[model samples]
Each structure stands twice: as C-alpha cells, then as structure tokens.
Target: MARDRKPVKSKGGRPSREQAAEINGRILSAATTLFLKRGVDGTSLEAIAAAAQIGKPTLYARYPDKSALFAAVIRAQVDAAMPPITGVAETATPAARLRQVGRAVIEGAMKPVPLGLMRLYIAEAPRHGALIREVDRLGRQAALEAIAGALAGAGGADAIDRAHVVAAHFLDMVFVPHQMRALLGDVPDEADPLHPTLDARIETAIAAFKTMHLLPAE
Candidate 1:
C-alpha cells in the first residue's frame, strides 16, 4: 500500500463579483434568445448553458430551475424598458407625483421589447397561463407600488384602502387602452401615439384620487 497522499485541492476558487456578474449576464442573454426563439417550453437548461458557454453547474447555481431563470429574464426585460424612478419629496403635490409615475409607466409600455414580449405571453398563455399571469403581476408591480405610495401619502393613514382603489383606477385608466393597442400591433413602431391620452388620463386619475381619498366629505 502506498503512503497517504495530501488531500486533493479544490478545482476552482469562488469567482469575483465582477466575474459572477458577467457570467450571469451571459446566461440571461442566452436564455432570453432561446426563450424568445423557441418559447418557454421548448428551451432547455442545457441549451442555455451551452449558448452561454458556461457549465451546467454555473447555470444551476445562479438559477435553480427554468421558472426562476425565466422570471429573472422577464424582470430584467421589464426593468430595462421601464424608466428609472427616483425618490420624490413627500411634500410634492399629488398631481406632480402622479405625473412622475405616470410618465414612467407610459414610457415603459411604449418600449419595443415589451410589445414583443406581450405578444409572446398572449401566444403562450393558453398552456402557460399561470406563468404568464405571474410575469404580468411582477412586471406591473413597481409601477403599482409607486402609485400606491403616492396615493397613500396624499390620502393619509385612514384612507389606505381607498388609496389602493385609486391606484388600481389609475393603472386601468392610463394603461389599458394604450397597452392593448400596443399588444395588438396597433401602435406604430417609431412613436407612441398615446402621449396625449396619457397626459389626460394622469390628470383624471389625480382628480379622482383627490376626490375619493384626499377631499373632505361635504
């Protein structure tokens, strides 16, 4: 029998933050291309790893499974399209707040990637309806939260329920028609023709929120 040997060293060390980020970027880029090209069901982890030029372990380490990876991709897609929302002063008027959030929503919905993704969601919804619903809920979450926060601030503590109601109304009023048009390929590729309508809807939503949440009862 041979003498005991030293323990085998680990094959690789942990990657630096920058390396991890770059690997994640590659995985997501590959996943996005495959998912869009083949639909969610047709894409596979192996394909994503191969396309990304990384090992299967690396892909799994970052995302446990396809749904998680799909969600990450979807979230990134929406975040890329959506405008960056920074903090606004608490004392800002409700109209100003509404306008700020409203502009972001409109601009985000107008992005080309969303339009294609919307169409894909609709096409795949029959079989993957629940997943599609989850994606939509997440995609709209930031906008809804921002709107709710502004409404809550203006409406005060007692009006939280009414604030949610106002936020829902604002979303429906501003997004429904324009988003539907975009999804159906009715909107032009170059510009959003709904800009004027968005402005009108913002004022309307603000007025409604004020009356329903902010104003004193007569």
Candidate 2:
C-alpha cells in the first residue's frame, strides 16, 4: 500500500489592496482596448476577461454587466481627456493664459485615446444613448471647471458668477468648432499653414471675448 500523502496547503489568499487596484487597472485597460477595437456591442465580458487574464466572475464582481464596464471606460477616458487647470496659466498674461488653456483643451480632445473613445461612443450611441449623454455632461462640466480655473486671477470676485457662462462660450468658440471639424475629417494638421489655423482661432476668440467684455478687466 502507498503511504498516505500529506494534505496540500492552499497558496491563495485575498489580494493586497495594491494588487487589487492593479488588477482593476488591467481589467479597465483590456476593456478599453477591446471596446475601441471591436465596438462596445461587439465586445463581450468573456473577451474582456480573457484579455485581462482575469476570471469572468472577477469581471462581473467589479462590473455587474457590459454597460457598467463600458461606462467605467468612458469615465476614465473623460478624466484623461480633460486636462488639469492647475499651473497651466500661472505667470502668463490674461489673454496668453486664455490661449494656453484653449490650446490645452483642444489638444486634450484631439489626443488619439479621446478620439478613439469618441468614435466608440458615436458608434454605440444608439444603444447607450443615455450613458453617452451622461458621460458628455460630466466631461463638459469638467472642461468648464478647468476653463474657469484658468480665468480665476483675471476675473475679479464679482465676475465669478459669469465665469462659467464665459467658460462655456470660450469652449464653444475655441474648442467645439475645431473638434467638429476634426470629427468630420476636415481638420488640418497642427503644422499645416492653412487658413483658420489653431492660433488664428485662439486669437479670434480672444478678440471676441474682449469685444464682448466677457473677459474680466486687466
């Protein structure tokens, strides 16, 4: 008779907080890649789990379903696409600062990741309309806040109320038009010496703000 074998000890235990966070990051990264490549509807949780090297149960535990995972991916993209306002305008003239902020906003929006995410959203909007709209609202709010932060020192305390309104207009004037052109495949490269270049738009926006007295007194 063979000797009785010793009972095997389990090597598994709960993941450390850092390890859990790293796993979550991997899941989101994998999901984003799959969603962008295959479109959200075409991508499934099984695919995501396989890409992430995690079990389906793990993915489901973090995100109840595909929509929830998609929402998380979009939220992360929005956060990345909206640049931080801090230190962007420090030590610059008011007009210069506005231009810097506007440039940052445009560049952030035009980045490959954000553009890919936008394409994904547009393709999947029919089924995820509400989710997409909510994501848009959150991104817009964040952009407005960043623009407002750039306007802080220029605008006196009394101008605070109008800052957000002006910020919205500024975003529309400098960002929305360019972004629309970009989405339509009509956008010229930044290095292109063409009519209505990025700098031209920024200058025009500054002039409009000055004429409307929308910018605070300098």
Which candidate tops lDDT? 2
* lDDT by residue for model 1 (114-218), tens: 777777778878866787888788767766776667646756666666656666777787777768866665643434445335566676656766676552322
For 1-218, candidate 2 gives per-residue lDDT tens digits of: 11212223335756666677777888899999998888887898898888888777778889999989999999988998887765664567667777778788888998887988887888889999999999989988888887777766666776655667678888887778777777777766656544267788788778888888877455
Query: Model-by-model lDDT, in order?
Result: 0.72, 0.79
- Best by the TM-score measure: 2
lDDT of 2 at 39: 84
Clashing pairs in 1: none
**Residue-level error in angstroms, candidate 2, position 133:** 1.1
Residue 12, model 2: Cα distance from true site in angstroms: 10
Off by over 4 Å in 1: 1-12, 16-18, 41-47, 55-68, 75-82, 154-156, 188-196, 207-218
Off by over 4 Å in 2: 1-12, 89-91, 154-156, 189-195, 216-218
